[model samples]
Target: MSQTSFQTPTNKIVLSISQLNQQSRNLLEGALSRIWVEGEISNFVRPSSGHMYLTLKDDQSQIRAAMFRGQNQGLSFTPKNGQLVQVRGKVSLYAPRGDYQLIIDHMEEAGEGALRREFEQLKQRLSEQGLFDPAHKKDLPDIPKHIGVITSPTGAAVRDILSVLKRRFPAAKVTLIPVAVQGDKAKTEIVHALDRADNFNQGQELPIELIILGRGGGSLEDLWAFNEEIVAQAIYRCKIPIVSAVGHEIDFTIADFVADLRAPTPSAAAELVSPDQQELQQRIQDFEQFFVSTIQTQLVQQQQKLTWLQKRLKHPGQRLRDHQQRLDELDSRLHNAIQNALQLKKTQLRASHTNLLRVTPTHRITQLKNQQNNLKHRLLLALQNSNQHAQQHISQLAQRMHAISPLATLARGYAIVSDPDKNIIRTSEQLQVGQLIETQLHQGHVVSEVKRIKKK
Candidate 1:
């Protein structure tokens, strides 16, 4: 091989910036195809296009990461700034800016993940100990005379519970036991309140049958107090039925597992404890109507029997002259009274039957059929009348046509004389001497020629 043919100019080996960056990207991507990085998320930006851009940083350094819309859409939770997260992605360099970025495919909370694992472990342990057993769970009262609410008095949870209780059943007496629902003191306050409520309920003559221990929606940190073991133990030891409503529907706590019943929200807990007044009133009204109807029906039946007996009493047979004669009168009176009563009942039943039929579909259908037939007959009669008028109009038009027809004139003893072109000559002025012409009469046409012209 020639030296110059195989070798390039060696003075300087220059490369395009794009080519350099492209090779670098391929190298970086290939070297670290898939890896997991744990860091605190910062400067998270989500634009209208749905792509999430953020910086994953630790104590020393940070790197840009992008989670495209396709991968991030299935996430159960949203990522925020300063959140500890573990992300799986591929490393790549941007050719345009010569910058490196990880193309993240998945993400989850780092610190929260550990907490959730612990939560699951504790749940399993408690479940094995029969803490969540249904046999141990007491039934909620149908109508709790008094309810004790253990939560922060100033929190939205208390307001929601109070409003729902008042709306559903105003008769229920509510006692609010103020407690902290979050922070380091939240667990202790809740445990103490549960104990105090239990003591109060036992000491008082009119005891509360139900206890609602709960709070509102929040992050895992904000709701960690409910997951404390001491709070769960307190709920387990309480004699009164407890309703656990710690957060929104998605959030659950250890207290929820140990309590007699778990409601999704404080309002829902209130609803569970209180019977709806409107529904109760409707039920009462229905029962009353049913009772009254039953009583009236029985009374009517009894009245019919009593009337028959009264008739027999009013027409008692005369004192017996002979034993056989008295027996005959008694039998006759009994038969007649029974027959009258039966006849009256049959008449009333027939009236009821007729009234029932009047409201039935068959009766309405028959009535509608009669009305439809009537309308159909009227339409046919109108059509016949219209046809008759049309026929009369046609006869009048025929008479008018005949009156204007030239044949009518010929029929009246007059002939229509025309020149060879068939133009009628109405007057002698239209006639010319020696002009061939034809005369149309009533019966036939005659050929003729004008022999003379006369004016008169």
Candidate 2:
């Protein structure tokens, strides 16, 4: 029976290369959905699509990995060969090449993840303790006369800050308190630098009005000094306003939140502390003009007052002379008045004498009677002219009234027709057959009934 069954095997399982690869990919992906891998970066390549192709390797083993553009863009530091890194991704297989790889979603420097976790924890604690309270922050001087810089003396950050300060505001004196920016000594040095800058000058130099605590851009580990708790405390406790400018625009540390102000770069920090030269010049010019204008206005006001006072002022001698002149004028007026009165009396006496000689009482009475007759004739003529004017005015008024009178219009062979309700019939349509209406003529009115109507 076994020999009979061994004739042929038609049901043997077979698969094409593509099918095999696809099945293998499905199996691998399903089995290992997510995992964390740590190794040194190698064969790093970034294609035009921004997708990163790299190989992760340990001492004895290596694996291909891919970090797509979307996932890799959020990394703070640039990746390079030989750099140790940690990646979180899913296991995947490339069917076309039949190669297996890790599809990385997140990646960072190996120690950076732990540092960032610590950084966040510290930041949370500090925030809860109110170290970053706005009330604790001091306002930056409008124009800082003395600026203290805390950074490495040989680092690019100091150079950048000095250059900006020189260009923007040379008047401000910069005092450099050099400190190590990175490594084991960085945090302590930074804290000491902050303290020295805060308590600057025991009458040795100008006191620091503002402090610039900054460093150049770097990886999270390189900028760790600014993230230290002691450094944050120093910044918080410092009486002088501190401007933290560590790393690039995208990088943030605990110092940034605790300081009075945060600048994206060291140069930006310098610009923040120091006022612009051109702006100061412009302000000085404005103040100069205001002072000049104000002085000129006050001088003009005082001059006007002086002129008014001069007009009102009089000398004592001039006042006596004026009184003398006034007395003389009054004496002359009194003399003229007496002379005129005497002359008037003489004229009256002469007139009385002439009346006694040329005319009697009866003659005077006749002259008065003639004058009265003349006045009466004039009055009568005036009355006649006034009456004539009044009659003409009345005639003109009568003609004007008659011109616009309705009775006058009716007298011109036109009759006004109205309904029985006294409503004017403007058109024949207003009249209906058998409706009673009133017709107004020049002298009277007649009531009539509407007959056959005609309209034109």
Candidate 3:
């Protein structure tokens, strides 16, 4: 019965426009704040102010996203439409437009595979063009006097490099080629810096022997400018050797492959280009000490040898006296030897005279005649023996001569026919048709002519 009376259904919850907007903003901001979203980028736009506006959407949903100038400036690669990306940001309602959006703090390509694929493609193209060949790489100077640095002027990398160089070798000179290390203009600036550093060799200025290209530690995106193909090519084409120090120990880039050497950090690159001055000084001192000690030792040895030689040296007067004594002894011995030999010869002659007298007849003429007769008989026997031996030798010689002589063969019923002018015979090949010939025989030689030719 109480509901019988008709009344207009009414519910009152009054709110102002600012209050509505505030409530909507609070609800949306509270619900979707500080989120991580993975989606494909679409409708991407980069304004001249260096701000990025884009839509991130999955198959079922979509959201508007914005990366402001401050955040976008730090990015290495330009974000493109349809790129699979992950964004970290807060979801907030744009109060003025009355729309939900994401305020992105960070953005990255979705997976490592995509980045690796691009890397491989670029590497392949460069390799095919001979950019990555070992033969094309320049050799680093063994000792660099002047090293050029291409990096950010105000950075930890430069400081570390300078510290290391100054400590290792204070005398080495370093020149900085300052350039932007990040942002859109970083690659171009790096290329320009390299060119400028390389071209600095003019007139009387000493050319830079080495180059250190480096940057401080950062994420992959933060170091992506060094991975660009153009940067790699520039490094490869540099006539001077380049040491790449792009990031930390674990980081590597295309520049690392193209450079002549790679350092783990900027400090390491500086250390590579210079020798330790303190260590070198210490080594020089050691060598000097060694040399002095060696010289002293050698001098002592030579002095000992000289002392021995002084003791061995004899005075000229004493040497002459010794030679005179030896000569006198030799003269005495020679006189004794000659006297003994004369005595022995006289004794032998006496014995021989006695024997001769005993064998001789008393009459001088008869004895002489008997002696002559004996000598004549012996001489005749000797003469006969000599004649027989000579005959045997002559016969042997004749036999040997007969064996080798062609004349002997011809005497044994053979004749030699030779071409008169050539004096050649062994075969018919020496004769031509109608050629005059000389025939040699044991009896005589006859002139002849070739009437017919027979070869067999």
Candidate 4:
């Protein structure tokens, strides 16, 4: 029981650097919750995965941040460096680098973002007012002859529009009204230009047909003049149809919605207003060819009718003679038909008379009379032969009877004897002594007594 000692157990807790980092990440993420941050953006990089990597910084501090594609895609405008932004996100540790970072869920521009919000609000308000309704919009002219343009006259937009108009329909004329396309003064210039076009079209013989309102592409601030409420109202009130072709196809302003139609570019608006001359030429040629073909067909049909009429012309006497000949031929055929029919009927009647004579009742009666005479003769001869045969047979029977008669035997001298009882005796043995007997001859009889009987 003497020496007991305590020693440390062999088991020990162990971890690699990666395992330590992962545990730290779990702890840090659990401790820090989601929060809002405001800072100017720097070192902003967008990768092929659509995820944005950036650093949010202030004068003294900075923090690494990430905004995934799904979150960044909701932003209306692209984010850039040095842009002040507000972000809402959760704190997270990027385990590979063992670095702490924030994962953003939402982002919005710090200052100019308010203007974008105001643009959407005004658009919604006017839409509810029905200013942008399709029923309220005027229809563009099918082929406008006199077009009016309201834009910066020296801009590229005017050059492209003029080129398209000349190429498509050189018959059309475009009147350009030069104006400032931006700044606070730009919206006023556009309004006055639209009113002036309206006033000019009222009493003119060849009125302005369509109006094109446009400018080149720019940032939202650069294009803000067209977004003014007064400009939208001016387009709405103009009697002449307006086609708003402002900026690139992707860029939109308030004027685009208020106009009668919106073209993606100024050149496209020109094409819409001008009709193709080549199409009209082809249609005219088709009509000419159709007219010529119809007339020719009618002439040929009339010529054929004239030829038929000439063939049908005839002399009255020749027609009458032809009719008389046909009538004579019909009469001859009718007479021949009647003769042939009468001949057939006579032949049928003679054959019928011969058949009637063969089956007459008088001839049948004569043959019956001959048969009756022949049968009568045969019956008389048969009766005579039968009577003769019956008489001879009766005579022969009488002779036979006469030969077998008892009197015939008596006549031959043979006598018959019997006891007095008249019983005949043919043997002596039949007689008894002292019996009286009688004898008969042909004409007499005798009585005697039996004296004795002899044995023999």
Model 4 — which ten-residue stretch has the worst lDDT?
1-10
Candidate 1, residue 220: how far the Cα is off, in Å: 1.2
Task: Candidate 2: list runs displaced more than 4 Å.
Answer: 1-110, 314-456
Q: Score each candidate by Cα lDDT.
A: 0.90, 0.90, 0.86, 0.89
lDDT of 4 by residue, 207-318 (tens): 9999999988888888898888989988888999999999999989888999999999898888888888897678789999999999999999999999999999889998
- Best-performing candidate as measured by TM-score: 2
Point out the higher-scoring one by TM-score: 1 or 2.
2
**TM-score computed on alpha carbons, candidate 2:** 0.48
Provide the lDDT at 439 for model 2: 91
Q: Write the per-residue lDDT of candidate 1 for residues 225-288, one digit (tens) a residue.
A: 9888888888888898999998999999999989999999999998888999999899999999
Q: Worst lDDT window (10 residues) for model 3?
A: 1-10
Question: Model 3, range 1-456, lDDT digits (tens) per residue?
Answer: 131323355655556555566788888789888889999999999878878899999999999999999987776567788788888988887867778789999987787646766777787887898877888778787768889999999999999999989888978788999988887889998888888877786553678989999999887777878978879877876777899998999998888888888999998898888889888899999999999999999999999999999998999999999999999999999999999999999999999998888776576678788999999999999999999999999999999988989988987989977776747688877777788998888999898888988998
- Candidate 3: regions farther than 4 A off: 1-113, 128-130, 134-143, 202-206, 308-314, 317-456
Ranking by lDDT: 2, 1, 4, 3
Pull out the clashing pairs in model 3: none
lDDT of 3 at 22: 70
TM-score of candidate 3 versus the correct structure, residues matched by position = 0.46
